[model samples]
Target: MIEKIGNAIKDKNKSAVLLLLACFIFVFILPAIEFTSNMLSIFLFSLIIFLASYPISRKVMFIGFVVILIELATRATDFIYVQYLAQLTTNLFIIFLVGSVIRHMMNQKNISIYTLVKALNGYLLLGIMFMSLVAFCDLYMPGSFNSSGNSDMELVYYTLITLTTAGYGDITPQLPLAQSLAMLIAVTGQFYVAVVVAILVGKYASKN
Candidate 1:
């Protein structure tokens, strides 16, 4: 079984596999589990940092490590501004890193299972990153959003909904900043799908 798993990973792109794992943890596991602890958050952050760093440059990886440490350190602090700074910087770095990975995948000019996986990972990561941004806005301005729950999982769900332009209307952003961010998230989702899907589909078509 171990050998089989190894072969499967080898068959696909390593980065894609890692990204998928991170996505699974964020989308499925985190939401399913109750009473998420700080330890769990740290573990999840570590896993994601590991997953995301492999495909990036050493310098980028170093910066990511630093940001993660900052987040871990300040996450428990009472200072809201400090928390926001860490979270925002970490999310921004991740967004840039994932975008870089997507660009790298596109440059390869061959569409494979891993390429598609990476594309999906990029999309999911966008939702996660923006969710953090919205959460940050919430930190400074409470009730920036109206939701059934204010947990991280709920925020993630809302982020996905906004990204897909579903607009279920259950969760509404109240603050102007939240509203603008939501709009930007929707537009970004549309643009990413249109542009990235076109490139990948065109490449696949040309290859065949």
Candidate 2:
């Protein structure tokens, strides 16, 4: 079983699949259930982070995991400045890790189903990273975002809507820095879809 887990970690596709599964559960399923204890959410998020980190660097992964533990340790405090700081730092690392994964996927000599999955994974991870940035900004400057910094689900929704350029206008950024970051997220999403996604689709079709 240990060897099998190691093999899965070494395979980008397997890691991507696991990440997607964890994300789907956390993003879609967990929100609907009314649970007073946050144990379920914590478990799902940790699982997602572990699986996503597996495909990147082990050292980076270890650091992220440590940051997560510290974040959890500080959760009970009345003042959570340190918790937000740790979250921001860990999320920045995650952004780099996901970018590395995307770079590796694009540098592949041949496209396959794994490549396609990795591409999708990159898209999802990119949105999540931007969401983390937005959350961090909100924590840094209270009322920077239209929504209260209370629910992860709301942040995920805002991130997806912003990435897709839907701009429902429900969660506008209040501060200048937040506005700039929002615009950057929108542009990055467009560029990714127009360039990277287009190239990947073309290559996949050519392979078939």
Candidate 3:
């Protein structure tokens, strides 16, 4: 699938570039739009899982989407509490897609992984950056902004702190919106760390 996309780009297929760009732009739109937490959760999650798995395997991706929907209905609505995580995940998927394309392009240009890793790393780091950005954008998000922690910057810093699980309690949420965000960060952060680290460790062990 990636190879075919690469060929299309190399051939300067205008339609193909536009299609990819459209998908790429969807990432930014989800964050910028003011969606209620409930609405955002369903829409964004479905969109992201669809985008990620669609290229590699449509059937498997469909199954993944169903599983996520079920999870949302049955268990975890915390996802909606901090829709920023959803936005960040969407942006991260876009970053990964863009990186994959750039890697393919560079591969054509015969660049080394030694050089490619730098770009890959930069895109991955954008995940962290986007998390911070989403927290800021929520200030403008349609939901009620509970003016907690004095300023937006303070809230962002605290969001990062909660996300990293560094709960020193210098700042805390006094409002429902802020508390929900904190809860989202705490749970989401743990899940993210556990899954990502487990995958990396599993890969290393298998490689050994």
Best by TM-score: 1
Residue 125 displacement (Å), model 3: 5.6
- Better model by TM-score: candidate 1 vs candidate 3: 1
- Once fitted onto the true fold, the runs of candidate 2 whose alpha carbons sit more than 4 angstroms away are 1-11, 32-35, 76-81, 148-151
Tell me the tens digit of each residue's lDDT in model 2 across 30-55: 65564567888778767777777766
* Model 2 lDDT at residue 123: 84
At residue 23, candidate 2 shows an lDDT of: 71
- Residue 205 C-alpha lDDT in model 1: 74
Measured by C-alpha RMSD in angstroms, how accurate is candidate 1? 2.7
Provide the clashing-pair count of each candidate structure. Answer: 0, 0, 0
The global C-alpha lDDT for each of the candidates, from Candidate 1 onward, is 0.77, 0.79, 0.48
lDDT of 3 by residue, 71-179 (tens): 4454446656445555444455544554444333334333333223323232323333345444545554534334463444454455557777788787766556656
Compare the candidates by lDDT and give the number of the best one. Answer: 2
List TM-scores for all candidates, in order. 0.86, 0.84, 0.36
Cα lDDT tens digits, model 1, 1-208, are 8787656444438756866887778766777675556677667766666566666666876888888899888978999788878887887887787687677767876687677777887787777678778777776778888865646777777888999999898888988889999999999999989998778877877777
User: In candidate 3, which residue ranges exceed 4 Å CA deviation?
Assistant: 1-153
Worst 10 residues of 2 by lDDT: 26-35
